[model samples]
Target chain A: MIDTQSSSGSKLVWVFFLLLFFAHQDFWLWSDDSLVLGFLPMGLAYHALFSVACSCLWAFACFRSWPEKLEQWADEAVDPDDNRSAS
Target chain B: MSDFTFLASAGEPVSRTPLYVLLVYMGLLLALGVLSSRFFRGTSKDYFVASQSIGSFMLLMSVFGTTMTGFALVGSSGKAFSQGIGTYGLMASWSGLIHSAVFFAIGIKLWSFGKKYGYVTQIQFFRDRFDSKQLGYLLFPILVLLIIPYLLVGLISVMKVVQPITSGMFPDTFALPDKVLPNGKSIPHPLSGGVPGWLSGLVVSTVVLFYVFFGGVRSAVWANTFQTVVFMITGIVAFYMIADKLGGVASAADVVKNHAPEKLIREGSIGDWHFFSYLLIPLSVGMFPHLFQHWLTAKNAKSFRLTVIAHPICIAIVWVPCILIGIWAAGLYAAGDLRIPPLPGGGPNANAALATMVRTLVENPLLSGLLMSGILAAIMSSLDSQFVCLGTMFTNDVVVAAMGKDKYSDRQLIFLSRAFIVGIVLVSYFMALYLQGSSVFSLGVWCFSGFAALFPLVFAAVYWKRASLGGAVGCILATLFSWCYFFYQDIFLDAGAGHGEYLVQGVMPVTFVFLASSAGMILGSLLTEPPSRETLKKFFPTLS
Candidate 1:
């Protein structure tokens, strides 16, 4: 279980930054002349779709890679039942 | 209604209308300040960080609003006019992802640390985490220096938009001197009889100062939320009206396809290296002191979830229209379909491209005034947060912490903060006046690069246990040195070249600066002692 969890976590981190890397790369240099929907330029349309992909990917990160310890710390700090305050 | 017919149908110059709309917006911000001040609990903590009481929605809105400055609206559009559709790829799309990722990685972590340590300012974090008080001294000035240019970008853009919108309102009172054009025909200045840039900048500065001086961060948050809604709604409306005026979206795209097809494609002139390096600029958000202050205001780590998820969507809402408008302007100018406004010296002005397009395309005075106010909303949303953050930094980091926290009372701290805010506002306002005609996009990129170069320090400080005080200090000095060298080369030596130019071997200056700062940190830490074990445990308590 530990092995699977750690592997998945590392994989998620790699995938996140990899997506960012590809998003930043200007692959549209080749398809510069193409238009999407007969109105939007190919490059502009790619980025527009890329932005939605980013939103989805980040939402996944929030769900998967969110630090468990930090959540516990926040709960402990803000929760009235907890004996220790934040500071 | 044909395009040229609207020029003939131009009604009485509604120069005063934009100003009145802007005044009403300013009045709303002031009222919010006064109202939020009633909830002030008479504590410096409440005044500076709002007692860490900001919830998810307000936190998300304020962060989004603070990031979506006039740069996102006016700067993006202006740059798109010159650069093409790649403008979205250059900043906005990447920023949506990078900024949210930073908020998740850095912002939430900082919020957790701030709450655990009772820290208010970013300097406080560095000073404690690194176990070096001197680090604060080095950081306070550099952060403030970098931020001032960002502040100037906001001020300059406000003046740029307002000047054009309010032109011709005071023709009798303020007639501009006529100058001979390149074609040997004399034409009056476009903004000759309107509110001058200096006056517009001062008015904006004064309005921002009033609220930040009164309610501090709380008021800035409330005002940002209100402004965010105003700009987002009006931005969409402006985009629709402009598209309709240009004979619909399909027709507008057809115009570009026929006249300026190069704009639709990523021009070969923009090298791959320059395009890729534009990605590094968004990393600057990780180190923005204003963003740091906002991060510290989150009620808990969970509050950041909304910001991380919703922020990209908010960025898209604000950016797409601006980018499209700018690209559309290029096509319209090329086809001679629109009467493109000339600059003061009588050439096509890219800086005022968006305002010119809007004013020319939209015939309704009421709609134009609303659109102008929406642009102002975007500008002022950023100015308030920056104003309050500087004041908070000075009071918490410089005055109280340096002088000893016990040396001043809560009331005295608030008083000092307000005084410093007014002083900085005055300095920025004057600087804006002197630096008139600077491109908002270029100025904004320079400022962001400076901050992005310093990202190594914060990233290491938070994540690496071995990151030492010397390392933090070293990174800062390295960043400042490279920042100055590149800024000098780009501004003075290059004769005001655009971002497409390379610093060395087709690489951006940010590439070198980021590397140097990272190298400085790693080398400085290794050469010196590692951070004490106790210090590491404090920041990384979960680790054994």
Candidate 2:
């Protein structure tokens, strides 16, 4: 049911990895004088924003690549009849 | 020394209030362990894997708790204090994304396979996947060896945090012998009146062991959930208080800008290669034996959905506060607003950086006690899981498998597991007492690097159809050899000169070892025969 091999899904995975690659480079925070919002160091602020972006990107990865067949398999393993009987 | 006399010491009268809070927290964990055992089914399956019935909420908390060890709190703050805001870029930012990615890629697949095949331990999976029992023989020792040092890091950190917070509580009882230096000035040791490292280490070990010995993995999951909540709340509270004490966010930023501007930026001292190398370290989570065990406890594959979605967010919530506090500590010190504590040997001790900030800034004794308990919560959460995982490995992989499946009864198997857990705790406790001065961050990095080097094996095993038994063996051997070489160079040959500094041509050693292991796996598989057709079909049913 899941289409991890689909073009869009695979592309998203590649994009996420690329984003991570650039995030660690710390290029924007290279200067000691860089400051954001009048108080935060530019580099610290960059990483803080980057962490938020990572959360969003990972959520997208889950939406695109999560395996559907595994969920179905799990449902089959836990029968509805057994639940009713236990109740 | 009378008890009344012991109660009076220098520097703001030590309070027993914090110690009471910690005792209550420990009591709550013990109660949870006892309660969970009421549902035990008296089978090896229930004892080892909770009969695979953990729901999504419990699963998420346990997995997150196990992964976020003392290093995340004590080590991260300490490192950020020394290295600046670059600490977040080095670890938390990457871990947030990579840890969840691994959960999606490896955790789901392993869970499905485990449910279908009735597999409990990682060794069982490797033994069947390669159709070679010898692979388990090779992997068992390496996995345990890597994990022991990781366990010691957690144990050592608990002692470090507790000793300083509880200092001056029992001055006379723990009094130090005064020594006259060549200058003819007699001075008492700094930690003389505090709870010694050995006693704190023993107390934490015993508390964790008590719960684990009673309830097995199920109790560990429950305990982790409780501790995770405790630490998250305390971590945020400590952050707000410290920021206020430093005279608001704007004032603190001004201090850093004027005095220690380097702590704000990274490019000047932390090279590009060093920054890039940190990305490799988080991959070690994929190959953690304890994590693998937690993954296998999922009631079904759906249990993983919440974990994958929420993991990055949870990481952000905990890490941002600790990283900010450490950075603030550096600024305060630079501006001459705070005094950094001297180590026992009389230098600025970075490991005590976070503790000193909290103790100096947060004045309310009740609040301080709660905060200390929260730090211990983060520490003890990981310790319980790691302790149980080792016990599970020793009993399942080494004992039952070697003695033949039918030789031991279920009760005997549980007994064996509990005994092994006790043995491991005692050994690690002694090691913690002996290796008192080692840096938690450096020890943690080495352990993570060794596991990260072996990540190629687990990645290939799940994805690559052509992966052979020879390749798996080669990957393990290459990782071990690289680990030993770097360790020898850093510890012995260099006389600890490169401790916590990126080595291997200015890059972290994980980068080289990861590349070497991957290449070895590829070449070895190409040189040897591919896995049999039936073996490939079993793992990759859709492709076949």
Give the distance in Å from residue B230's predicted Cα in candidate 2 to where it truly belongs: 0.5
List ranges where model 1 is wrong by over 4 Å. Answer: A1-10, A26-31, A74-87, B1-15, B341-346, B495-502
Best by lDDT: 1
Locate the minimum summed-lDDT window of 10 residues in model 2 chain B: B1-10
DockQ of each: 0.36, 0.28
Give the candidate number with the greatest TM-score.
Answer: 1
lDDT for predicted candidate 1 compared with the true structure: 0.81
TM-score of chain A of 1: 0.62
lDDT of 1 by residue, B261-372 (tens): 7878776646687778878899999999888889888887888888888887888888888888888888877777654456655566777878877777776777888898
Pairs that collide, model 2: none
Estimated TM-score for each candidate: 0.94, 0.93
Q: Put down candidate 2 lDDT per residue, B206-257, tens digits, no spaces.
A: 9899888888898899999999999999999998887777677777667776
